[model samples]
Target: MSEKKKGPYKQTGNIAVDMVAACINHYEKQGRKVAYIRLDFIHWTMFKGYVLEQIPAYDLSNGEIEFDDVIVTQGSSLQVKPLYHELVADGKPKVYLMN
Candidate 1:
């Protein structure tokens, strides 16, 4: 039998916002929550290693940013436990990633 591949799946779109949104949406559709996101150097350069709580208001488009890449990981694993970014919302901590 052929085994299915686990991924550091490539997520891409015309803009950084779109790529991020697409990664979140992809997981939501699969009934999985995103645990963390890993950005390639190209994306890291654009966002400067920070992912904002809100999408940017200004156009953050440089043609070079068009193919921005990210890998979305879901579920819990020792491998990913150290990568979570904690967000405190309504006195509750939510774990997600920007690593």
Candidate 2:
């Protein structure tokens, strides 16, 4: 989903390296051999009700999806996250979805 909002900086989960492996899986399935993933993020938190309506699979413990890569940004907060990838602070191709 495309997001035109803002949010404060927040990260969730362990930001484990296992997610990288999953991204590799998707890339392999697509035959693109994913070199990297672009995670967009907006400053918005998802409510339980909204999660039920939008992402029922959403795990409150780890609300993020793991793919090839992820990025995080800082801005105003919202009622829900409308973006996916922001940008890795290190400037590397990899992204870590923090909150």
Cα-based lDDT at residue 6, candidate 2: 39
List candidate 2 segments past 4 Å from native: 1-15, 37-99
**CA lDDT of each prediction against the hidden true structure:** 0.39, 0.35
Distance from true location, Cα of 98 in model 1, Å: 34
lDDT per residue, candidate 2, 5-94, as tens digits?
A: 133222333232223334444444554544334332322232233334555765545444333233222223432433333322444477
Query: Cα lDDT for residue 47, model 2?
Result: 25
TM-scores of all models?
0.34, 0.23
Candidate 2's clash total is 18
By lDDT, who's the top model here?
A: 1
